[model samples]
Target: MRARSHSPRKPKPNSVMGSPKMKSKSKSPQKKHRAVINQLDYLNSQCHMEGCSVSIVVHSTRFLICRHQLCHASDYFKDLLQSKYGSEDFYVTVSSMSEPTPSTQFRWFVESSIPCPALKDISDETLETCMRLSRRFDAKGLEMRCTKFIVENACSRQPIVALCWLNWALKHKFDAQTQASCLPSVARLSLTALEQHRHMLTEKIFSDLLAAKLRGTYDKAVQVFRAIHRMDHFSVEVDRCPRCGRTRDGMRVKVNADPCRKQIGCDRCHRESCEIENKAGDDLQAFYQCPHGLVPLNSTTDECHCQIPNLAHHLGSRYYFRSENGTILNPPPLSPHTSRTFDPAEDTSERPGTSYKRQTSRDMDRREQRQSAVVVRLEMLVVSLQPEESVRRAEIVSFGSSVILSIAFFYIFTMLNAFTTTNIALLDKSSGCFEKKISKYYGQPKKLWERFSRAVSLCSPRLHSVELGAFANTDEFKVPLLAPSEDCVVLSLGIGKDVKAERRMRDRMSQCVFIGADPVNESNADLFSQVGKFYNVAVGHKNGSFRSYVLEDVYRYQEVAYMDLATFIKLNVNRKIVDQMMMDVEHAEYPVLPFLEKGGELSQRDIAINIEIHRPTSEDLQAFVGFLRRNSLSQQWIFINSEIHPFFKHIRLFMINGQNKECRRRFWEN
Candidate 1:
């Protein structure tokens, strides 16, 4: 197809060929073969990538020029194309892969379906025909562009692939314009690149959240640490004595027990007998230290008898310890292997970027803030938590999927990152499971948390609301996000429990936007409004509700027109508080999620919420808490804080923020 070069004047071609005509006729075929080989060599130069590795198939078709030499099943490439576009589109693309000339390509574009038999059963002769056709049409340039695009677009979801394509595109001088146009073709080549890639995004991707959490503040850090634990599958706590199987409690006693309750044995009854009941479960109350030493399996439920440890045999006996052989016992380690695993009792060394100390100067204020309180149990650590296994490979996988190459597919990474994973939770304390996943991405973290708020409300410390402590609380709470100002060190609550903890907290917070309750009037707004206002502090009154909010009420509650009072609060407070919120509204807290999600008011905050559970069964609580958990509002401390704020000191503060504001590992132990 090379045009002959000539001077400005038209040449007399016959005059020159007259003598050489005989020679020219003999050389044309040989010259054609050499041209085909040269083109193939050129293509080979660019086919260095893993995906592009292919031997030049010397194929030729009457109407085709460039033939792909890849040797997979015809269905294989068809399938890959089908995934990127429809099966129809794939066939269309492949149908003309062998054609080299733009002249025949027009027919390919016109054909409804790609002709199959052409190279479907590729043979040496057919390959050669394809190569001949390609040279005639000079289609290699077009083919190369198309192939590169399809593969790259298809791989957009795979971080590795995406990174590769990014690098490749740059290497080949493919501009963004080319990337946009060719991305679809790339996607068509790699079928699996769809939503499946999201799963590949790990904790490493969310280092920003971690950085924010570790910036300095403790409450925020604790909240974020818990969240990181949740995200990384390193936070949920389940106790199982990996060493033994006690019919009663699953975990083994790693250490020797005190002398008083010495019925140590690996029988079903002893397993749970001494273990503390975390949330709630089956009771093991059927034993008596009677002479026979007989122990009933369960107090009233089962009439079955369980074995008792032969404590009389030895001094420091474990469940597995034995004497003269009697009945075979389930194996138990000599002692318990009960030391903490993921979330240990001992505090980990503080992460870098946070170091602050306590101040008695704030003591008087701390004393004043230390009003009445509930005997806290595992404060702040527990939220809508699922066992590490709850997070699915599929969920993350989708985040990185392609389909993005197509303009039809929305490339929304921010939305994927904003998802709050709280459902499909395997409770550390109880049994029961939930289901389902949401499609589409939401950019704001608060939106995801609001969704999970219902789920979190299922547990004891139902989330009334939450705020990031100028840190990780951003997903659920509306706090000011700011860059670090001054030395700006944030100490753990235990490390620096100022009596005026609230004031101290308010004073020291920096690198954060202030998030406070805007005091929206609550009496008139409907459930949704109240919920929205509650999330964003702009509302004038307590934005959220009392402790009576229920799932059904939210679903069936009357919708009331509302104003943006909560927005005002955020602008006004300019300070974020990580306090326990009491939202026991009859129906108020459920509906405002949409509103709170908007206006960025729900950007920061973690109000350790105490929502009133009003369902007839545990399923409702489960559903509610599951919702909250999915939304990223982990259910922290679940309890009533104050009945009334000090403004009415004569009585009490209902669900007021805790004065201690200090949450550390020893919280439960203390």
Candidate 2:
């Protein structure tokens, strides 16, 4: 069935250019048609892809359909006919006399096999040229990068063919700027003539990844990238550190020391003190204290590196203290304290004569005075580890006070236990000037406690509250309604129709400026007018086209919500900020979301978004919700109403700017 079936039968030079079969003038229609079919076969045989054949069409009287079935180029011919005729058939009446004949020409379609290999040989330099050309906004270089590279390097003359290749390259994602720049020259070419033949030259250049990108197939694009690099083949293994291999949690911290106690606190978050300090300093020995009063070092032993108890220690409920003399640790048991003590190393004797002469070289009288300065030594007495008498004395001096304090605390706690709830309430009212009210209940038995130990008493748009201080370390630490910072807050609206909804939102932010289609880009202060005023904006478009523009500045706000629109808006909204999104991007929300995630540089939409579900097949709506869940966006839509499309359900708004892992899992499943 293949041409290779008779490859050994080399064609004669005359046979290669096969002669057309002649038919008798008086022959019946069937015989003439049969004869024409035979000639057509011979002509096709001569034009096998690359061989004992010619690459040209021969004049014949054959019926194209029958001739095609038995010809070497049958597949190619079938394609040619179907493209020329979309199924309808007509019988052509052939006559011996003809007035004129249409000219027929052959064009070679460079198949995939050849182009792939050629692309493989393309140098990285050529690729760079291609990429650069893609971004260029010029005319002389308006050719497709690859085509231009080929022309510049391959052609010594024949500049015109290079131009032809340039025309060919345009199909492969020509730099839009180049097309625009070259528009003037193309104006002279008849639009019909240009459409008559495209040559499909650009199709040869797009590698799979590039094609996926052009198609906006982001997931496919990611997959194609994986293929190119074998990214999964490699992974990161934490380096087993050389010394001790302890895997010390290494990070830098700057410290500001307390002036009184010389204790250091973290510069970034003083709420908790950090132990490590690779902070900058000149004197390593005195790393704890700089003349500027900030000491940073890694020694957090009994004494901080600065040799001072950090004054900041008092800032926290937990604290640490070190004694210069271990004996001071247990006043009464001095003998036992000495038993655990080690002698301090003596300082090296100062270079005697060196200090003497240096003192003389500087201010003579002052130098003399410095050289004669007296050094003081304080002597410490050591107690003998004699008998139980010293232990008894330790108990009397140190434990005596602790014993009294403990007894006093016991009595105080016993009496106050009855008033714990009352005290808690009084503390709440008195100390909550800058905090929300706190609720109190008696600490109860474990089983009883589980019934009401924790609860979100109420929700408010606030950043500080008494409940927060009490539940600071609880599982419910993060607040959903409470946002990060006031400066970073925004109540944006995706104002489409829904005039009632818009009006309601406007009242909420009556001070914010409204920008509609044909927008008068307002001033910043005007945009945020009222105290807590918002900025009312209709994204990208002025008023009513399906086209949406990007709001780069809007992304500065941490959250964005849209009911309906295109995917580009979603994507631009996702990057940098946008912790929450409100979906409903036109009637196209569901289909468009998939594209935004799939094609754009978006891995996940970590936004609490709500959508007025557009009318979609049940399967599609489920899939869309599932997709939202997979990407970790909550999908609690409450269908309170649906007028335009019955399938469109206005569900209860379910969002998640910040929620637990379970919420995340439920929202973005995959």
Candidate 3:
């Protein structure tokens, strides 16, 4: 290969190719030739040298590289050099400009002793150049190294930078590890950032990221609720106004006069008067003023005679107040000397002049009043905080209920939407085959004319249908849009010149595998081959030679090899289940329908049939409807193509095997 000419210039100080200038004073041609050979030998044995067998010229620079080394390292090089017309003098040019240039990176990659070079020493630009070259050359080793570097280091960078790397990896179809490692960066991204870069991500990745975010938010909310539940047991104390003697707490006021009243008194004297005037609201005061003498108090101080005993009893027992830190705030245990007596007769507060009966009544009333007052205060505190606790609990319950309902509604909507979109039609057995009463046509029509009219009027019970295929010509067909399956197999019984319907089905469901058959081996083979496997034989009742006619011209016919439906299915499908079968064999469906019914193929598995019945007579029509009814196949869609013959119409029908258990489970039970 010829190297491009360049102006003579001094070599850079750090050039890997070294100085290109050499001088020799020897006059003899033999000595100069020997010196040139020595120079080439030195270049071949250098650190960057792979071999001196082939020259790779990149612009003005040329490098000697080995063919075997390049071929082993890259698929592109292997295929190029192993081809019939490949020459040893071919040149590889690197057009893109980089810091070290593509030529330098290529030389380093091929000549390095290790499979992967030390990436830490290489600059980012040089690494990027290596990745580009590796992908371009289909170098698996280099691609793996690049992918490893990205997976290990990309997420450690800024989120935006990591997202850029992730987008690049996804676009290039990197390994799953690389994609997984980059997904964390997506989770770290803010909502606004994700929205801004949403166009860069695939739909599945975007949804996964959103789901992760929602899960995290829900977890945080749960943590908050747990903290609230733990801290809910703390008690709140209300401070009293020194002058008015009214209690005040945050956003709430409790007056001694009217505990349930919302409004406050106008002045301190008014509050005092209100407190003295409203005896009904104060249970303690009402107990004191009871005219029936149910409770009695000391006339001097108006204090309960059993107050000390009640306080001592409460403190010594299990009834203890707890602080915010859950520590017990009960007073010190009562000493034997200071402990009050529970019996009224042993009390020290009894007067010497008091009668025994009066003293007993006064002590009992005072003890009861003190106990009631203590109970009332505790109850008031509990009632005050009950509403807040109820509201918080309600909030948590509401949140949980909403989440459960949302999930249930989503599943219900998804199921309903799937059924609705499929356009499924369930059989109405009570309605009978025709719209009229079954008694009206109880027996089969005796006359041929009556039978023909009855067959024409026959209406298969269909709930709904969806049309699919090209709208232009007779290539258009209708079938229920069933759920997609990954391992779906479709059998195409005939292929004339058009495969529009098959192509549309493939577009809708790319996972479906199509096996097409046709008698003529003309353009039909090429057209059907684009979508799936095409067979040159025809499909019929039995495996034998059959006469087939062209759809365009019924008179033109040819003898073709034919295979039975069971044999075709067994040969192509391992599971013996055909998801869909499309047949348009001129007028051969009349004989094929009987074979399918007698063989019990429709009963064994779920198979959706889309057949174009060509030129059927009254008897043929009646037999066709009878076959469908016997096989438990419900018609989903029917089209009459009367363009060819008005009297003997070509009826196109799509039916599903409703009797099959698997069919009902997959299409109806959902």
Candidate 4:
């Protein structure tokens, strides 16, 4: 589909015609001086090129121009003109740069800087001519305008023009927008037109067109197939051979046959011999060669490739679709392979050229009798091996099905595991920072003897009086909460409609600075103003804009800014150790537990975390408590309250162990 190209012709010195002399008919000396002065003025007015000390003559017409303008347009022109011409010389003649003349295009190119060229007024051919000149001179702006005019106007009106432009664009590597405009028009060309202009198109363009056409043809065929199948009620029947009474799947093609055996078996033993096997194989082959051969339900017309004569009589409309007289779009070519030339001599049974005449009814009956006798003899021997073959096939199928199911189940299990895992960063061994895999259960279990001893001491009055830690039912170790003082740092997340709890904490610890945050607390902004800094942004599992559904029905759903606890703490608190933090976000606490465990923001303080668990199921509550208990950084919890409601519980006063004396001792010993 690629086209051949020719290089631009170089200008010849003799191509430029010599300028004619103006005869002086005026008798007065004043008139002659005025004429010379007028000619000089005309030259200066027409030439706009900078550093104009010369006139360039092309194809007999002379254009007075500047040296810099010519150089700016092309490196070839700059090198040629600057190397040959001098400042003293005022005139220079150049040969033919274009056919007929380059004067018209050259004038436009030099004068284009004075005013923007109106490309709409020019004919497409004229525009193309200018484009070629611009291409040669490397005039980028002129070429772009010319290309735009061709694509926007000419290509839409005339397809042939588009075809020509496509070739030009490909060769020159035109801008992407112009090429995109050419592709769709070229793709819609008819097959005949495509063939005619194949050489003008690039291989990629031609292939894309062909592929689109092929897909259209295939889609139409499928439509016809579906229509026929839907209209016919009994199209799903299995196909059977009339002569052998065998279905397609039960029979196979024969590779080797003995022509001499009019009977089913070979000359030796007449039982299920090589000759009978060959007969079965041959019958299978003949069925396969027929165009009306059976196809599976899940297959398409292309996969079947049926082309048998009298297919309508043999298999009815179920086997094929008649598309020429049909409404199907872009039907395939006639005679899929090649039309068979009909010859009366070849058709006649009496012909003696290369084949025998057709058998009479009497001859057919005799052959049938011999075939029946051989089939009866072979049936006994073949029937014995049928059961064994079927059993072997079943075993193979079962094994393959089992393997497929196993692989499918494994893939599903892996995907479920990945989806359920929480998004959290782990502490790196070198940095002691949370920056790896999501935290699951962080610390190791306690000894059996220690658990037994603690259980035996349950009779003590202090043990009964002490508050239970969060996840007390689980095996995780506990830490008690420490009361906050006046100089403590507090971070309040998800403040509900009421600010009574927050106000009470603020009044008790007046010296502490509290940062209160709530997504839906814009109406109560005035209340939190006196407490500390208040933000309307919601805190969630991650930093993103999450959809916050308003239950009031008037405003509907809206999106709000959400930042995770770790990020909010990092961005606002930086390296400060939070003394107490309270969270009441509806079911948004699960994803933030690991962040509090490993993040450096609260590692130096006994942070009391008070959070309300909304609509908590048994499994969810257990998992939440277990996560808090297993955290290595937060080794203690004060109290977990279940007095509010069985389903909606709260961890009222949970805290981490702030004292690191034991930790330092262990580190030094290690």
**What C-alpha lDDT, on a 0 to 100 scale, does residue 551 get in candidate 4?**
23
- What lDDT is reached at residue 377 by model 1? 21
Question: Could you tally the backbone clashes for each prediction?
Answer: 151, 37, 0, 6
Candidate 2 accuracy as lDDT:
0.32
Q: What is the C-alpha RMSD of each candidate to the true structure, in Å?
A: 27.9, 34.0, 35.5, 30.2
Top candidate (TM-score): 3
User: lDDT tens string, model 1, 1-670?
Assistant: 9999876765476556345433455644553421232222222333444333322223222222112332122333334333342111111222345444432443332121223234232222232233333333334433343334434454445444444443344444444443343333333322134223323222232232233332334334334534443353211123433335323366434422322244433333234533422111222222335444654333122322323342312122222322234333433333332221111112244534423222332453355335311212212123223567345534544544644444334435544443332211212121121112211213333343234323323432222122233221111111221213422212111101111222224445533232223122243223223122223222222333433212231323333322333443345433354333323233234443332221234423433333332221334334444433443333232222222211211111122112123322112212
Worst lDDT 10-window in candidate 2: 104-113
**Which parts of model 2 have CA positions greater than 4 angstroms off?**
1-485, 489-494, 499-575, 595-606, 625-652, 657-670
Q: For candidate 3, write residues 325-386 as lDDT tens digits.
A: 44434545766544232343434554457567667767877787688668757655544556
Models 1 onward score TM values of 0.19, 0.19, 0.32, 0.31
Whole-model lDDT for model 4 versus the true structure?
0.49
Query: Regarding TM-score, does 1 or 4 come out ahead?
Result: 4
Name the runs in model 1 displaced over 4 angstroms.
1-58, 62-562, 565-670
**What's model 2's lDDT at 486?**
20
> In what order do the candidates fall by lDDT, top score first?
3, 4, 2, 1
Question: Tens-digit lDDT track for model 2 on 455-498?
Answer: 21222222223121111111111111222332122223333322
Per-residue error for 237 in candidate 1, Å, reads 29
> Which candidate achieves the best lDDT against the true structure?
3
